[model samples]
Target: MKGLIFVELMNFMEEQFGELLTDEVVDAAAIPGDAAFTTIGQYPSAYASRLIGAAADRSNASAAELCRAFGRYLFCRFEVRFPTMIQRYPSARSLLMHVEAHIHEEVRIIYPDARPPTVTALEVDDALHVVYRSDRPFAHIAYGLVDQCIASYGEQSTVEWCEGNDDSHARFIIRSLHRSAA
Candidate 1:
């Protein structure tokens, strides 16, 4: 995983929870790297899992919920850090569609060893269908990203997600809703 993610997760914990809780989570994680992280460095993805698990244990929140919240924060971080990458898209659907081919590709070019999820988006009936396949089971996080993406466009959307036959895959179907004529 990218250290940037770990750094963001730590920041999320510190700000949302507290500095002491952040240290506790890191300590409970007991992973190799501990809490040391550099934005441009890489570490085992499992460390992130442990950090989230530790936070879940302390906060009495499900790991999925925590991951989803982190996803929302992650999207906001991207908006501030990489405005051009996201601002180029006119709609949430457009951004989701290009993630695998464009965004991940760029990540690979910049960090050759980085392993990111493979996302593919298609339109089915009236909804945008997205399939996310990755070794890491973090679809809840993806769901949050999709939710915030639509919100960022000032559009109302509902997302339904289902796990694949296995943990390595997930499908997200998002339907745009008509806002009331207020």
Candidate 2:
């Protein structure tokens, strides 16, 4: 995984849990490179899982839930750092459709070693259906990103998650409805 991810995770921990808890999580994680993360550096993904597990224990939340929340928070951070990426798409569905084709391609250009998840979208019964596949299990995080994307568009949306037969793959159905219409 990219060190930028760890850096952002640390930022999320501090902002959401507090400085003391964030420090505790990082210190307890026993991460390689002593948590001196550089945005361009790469680290083992297991270290990230450890940090998330520690944060989950401290917060009394499931690791999956925390990961998803972190994803949502990360989206806000991304918006701040890369406004053009989010601004170019008028809808969450549109953004999702281009995640693999556009966003991940840009990521590859910036950090050639980064292994972003594969995201594909299809339309079904007026809902945006997305399938997420990766060797690393971060479906909850993807869910959070989708949730925030809908919110960013000022749309009311419901995201349903379905675990794939393979542990590393997952599917999401996002249905957006107008706030007033609902």
Candidate 3:
């Protein structure tokens, strides 16, 4: 994982749970190197999982829920950080359709060591079928990101987790409610 992710996670925790709880969670997670992550630094993915687990243990929300929420928050942060990348697409559907070919490719170019998930979108009739595949177990995060992306685009859509072969593989079906009703 990249340090930017960890740094953003800390910011998300502080914003959502306050500084005290965030400090406690970080302390409990016991991440190496004082938990001071730089944007360009590389860290173990396990550290992120451990932090999420510790947060779940302290809070009422489950790890999956927290991951999803984090994803939502992360999307906003990404919008701020990479405005040009997002501005190229007029709608969330278009952005998602090119996530693998465009966005992730840009990420790889910027961060050669970063291992991002493969997000593939297929347009089927009135719905878009999105497939998420990754070595890390963060499909719930992807679900939340998709949810927020649609909402951010001012689109009325419903996203359903159609199936999951494993933690590494998940599929989501997104259909515009207005279009469907029409």
Each model's lDDT comes to 0.84, 0.83, 0.90
Off by over 4 Å in 3: none
What order do candidates take by TM-score, descending? 3, 1, 2
Per residue, candidate 2 scores C-alpha lDDT tens digits across 49-167 of: 89999999888789999988988988888888779977998878889899999998898887789899898999887778888898887878887888888877777888888755243
TM-score of each: 0.92, 0.92, 0.96
Write model 1 residue lDDT over 1-182, tens digit each, in one string: 88898888888888879988888889899966668898898888888888999999999789888988988888888888778889999988899999999988887897888898998999887888988789887777777777788888888888887645233577888887763232
Q: 64-164 in candidate 3: lDDT tens per residue? A: 89998998999988999899999999999999999999999999998899889999999999899999999888888898899889988999999998754
Give RMSD (Å) of candidate 1 vs. truth: 2.2
Candidate 1: lDDT of 13? 87
Output the worst ten-in-a-row residue range by lDDT, candidate 3: 161-170
Candidate 2 versus the native: TM-score? 0.92
Give the distance in Å from residue 55's predicted Cα in candidate 1 to where it truly belongs.
Answer: 0.6
Native RMSD of candidate 3 (Å): 1.1
Of the pair 1 and 2, which is ahead by TM-score?
Answer: 1
Shift of residue 71 alpha carbon in model 1, Å: 0.7
Clashes of each: 0, 0, 0
Q: After best superposition, candidate 1 residue 166: deviation in angstroms?
A: 5.6
Q: After superposition, how far is residue 171 of candidate 2 from its true place, in Å?
A: 0.6
